[model samples]
Target chain A: MRRRLDMQLDELNELLTHMGELCQVAINKATKALKNGDVSQAKKVQKADMKIDQIEKDIESLCMKMLLEQQPVARDLRQVSAALKMITDMERIGDQTSDIAEIVISENITESMELVELTQMAEAAGKMVKDSVRAYVNQDLSLTRKVIEADDEVDRMFVENKKELVEYIAKDKGKHGERAMDLIMVAKYLERIGDHATNIAEWVEYSITGIRIEGN
Target chain B: MRRRLDMQLDELNELLTHMGELCQVAINKATKALKNGDVSQAKKVQKADMKIDQIEKDIESLCMKMLLEQQPVARDLRQVSAALKMITDMERIGDQTSDIAEIVISENITESMELVELTQMAEAAGKMVKDSVRAYVNQDLSLTRKVIEADDEVDRMFVENKKELVEYIAKDKGKHGERAMDLIMVAKYLERIGDHATNIAEWVEYSITGIRIEGN
Candidate 1:
């Protein structure tokens, strides 16, 4: 029975890794679509989000089953409960990526140098998502802390991006204000993605140390 | 053992209700701060969020203990799991309300007629939080649906508020543009509060019917 529970735990890790990869793809494609002004690419990101949502439900039921059947305790219980918490943040990352895609397609924003910083912000957030999940799969405590610290950079970028966008709107007045607003919204979504990644890392830390980190 | 489990469930319900009340206070104070441009009031919202966070941690531990010790199955399992999911959203509502208050205090937005619609939006979101928690506490299926449906109105208000803020910014060019941007951020936060409330309502529905409502 112990060996069976261990095997199921391994399976859970694999499933979570797969979900994390999907989130990376969603954020990557959404930001790429934003950079290239490729409507089809944005549409693809939206479609992929549905799959992420389905996977979340599958993982949730599996966790519930493990709790019921294996009756995990202590560290094992933390692992299962943390996975349950981590997936919600992962799912939100997917949803926010889809939201960015929707903005890209609806705004029909053409490629511009203006989006360079926003793209960089998206890349930073996506890397955090990847590293945070890897931290959990490997139980790398240092990597989790790295993911947490990286959130500050994404947040700083958001403030800078907003300032730049506001200036653009100020310069163009009514002419390009809506487009500037759209880009600001995109930046905000990326920042939120970063925040969710930080949340996942914090949960990973809790699983490992049995200590919950405040203010993610 | 069954009676003990029932008693524990009732305790969980009471804890959740208290947490929900804290969320309501957070939202109410944040919006009131926005309406009055009272920076101190906004600061109070930030401080109150810490209490909400502490309560969420307490509630989470209770849920985990109930799950492990009681080893509840079927309907009881669903109730415990649903509580777990509901608290995350509730915690987010608290965080978003704090975010709104941060903007209000930092932007130093003075009282203006411009805030009327945004205040209304905040009120609508707060009501949803109250009703969703009430629905969960009472297990009222109809109230759950009502909370779900009210999200549409909050959403519509967000769109209208955004349009109005954009117009305000466009007309003023750079002078009031930052303030306008801050108001828009406040509006976005309120919309997210509405979404989180909808999520709680969906979990309430799931606890009652075992049917998950998709796309809140």
Candidate 2:
């Protein structure tokens, strides 16, 4: 029975890693679509979000089953519960990426507007997502901290991007206010994705140390 | 043992009600701060958010304890799991309310701009929160549907509010663009609160019928 439980835990880890990869793909595709003004790619991201949602439901059911069958305790219990928590954040990352794609597509934000800062923000947030999942899969505390610290850079980029967008709107004398707002919303979504990544890292820390970090 | 589990479930319900009340207070205080442009109220909302966060952690720990101690199955297990899912959304509602309050305080939005649509949106969102909690506590499927249906009105108000803000910015020709953006963001937060409420209602429905309603 112990070996079976161990095997189930390993399966859970593998599933979470798979879900994390899908999230990375979703975010990357959404941001790339925005950069290239690829409407089809944006649509593809939206479609992929359904798969992420389905995977979350699958993972949740699996966790419930494990708890029911094994009645896990101590560190095992924490690991299962933490996975339950982590998947919610991962699902939100997928949703936020889809939201970004929706904004990009609806606004018809073609290659006209400069997206240097927003792209950097996306890359930073995407990296955090990838690293946070890696930290969990490997139980790497240092990588978890790195993911947490990366949130600061994502936030700084958001602030800087907001300022630049505001200046652009002012220079256009409100003519491009709508476009500027869309860009700001995109940045905000990216920042939120970074936050969800940080949340996943914090959960990973809790699973490892049995100590919850406050205000990550 | 069954009786003890039932008693613990009762306690969980009471705790959830208390947390829901705190969420209501946070949203009300944040919206009130926006309406009156009262920085102190905004600060108060921010402080109250910490209390909400603390309560969520407490509730989560209690849920874990119940799961570990009782090993509940079937309906009882569903109730506990639903509570676990509901608290995350509730906590997010608090965080988003605090985010709105932060914008209200930092922007120093004085009592100059007309805020009729936003006021309506806040009231609608607040109702959804209250009704969702009531549905969960009472297991009222009809009330859950009511809460879910009300999200449409909140969403419509967001669109209208966005249009009005854009027009207001255009009239000022970017002079008050920053302020306009803040108002739009406030509306967006309210809309998100409504979404979270809808999520709670959906979870309530799941607890009752085991049928997940999509796009509520």
Evaluated with DockQ, which candidate comes out highest?
1
lDDT by residue (tens digit), candidate 1, B15-124? 99999999999999998888778889999999899888899999899998998898999888889999999998998899888888877776755454457788789889
lDDT of 2 by residue, B1-103 (tens): 4598888988899999998998998888888888788889999998888988898999899999999999989788888888998998898899889888888
- CA lDDT scores, all candidates in order: 0.87, 0.86
Which 10 residues in a row give candidate 2 chain B its minimum summed lDDT? Answer: B165-174
Regions of model 1 farther than 4 Å from truth = A1-23, A35-95, A98-114, A127-156, A167-177, A192-216, B36-40, B65-78, B105-114
Candidate 2 residues lying further than 4 Å off, grouped into runs, are A36-40, A65-77, A105-112, A173-175, B1-24, B35-95, B102-116, B128-156, B163-180, B194-216
The best candidate in terms of lDDT: 1
Error of 2 at B165 (Å): 4.3
Each model's DockQ score: 0.28, 0.21
True contacts kept of each: 0.24, 0.11
RMSD of 2: 5.5
The interface root-mean-square deviations, each candidate in sequence, come to 2.4, 3.2
Q: List the residue pairs that clash in candidate 1.
A: none
TM-scores for candidates 1 onward, in order: 0.72, 0.72
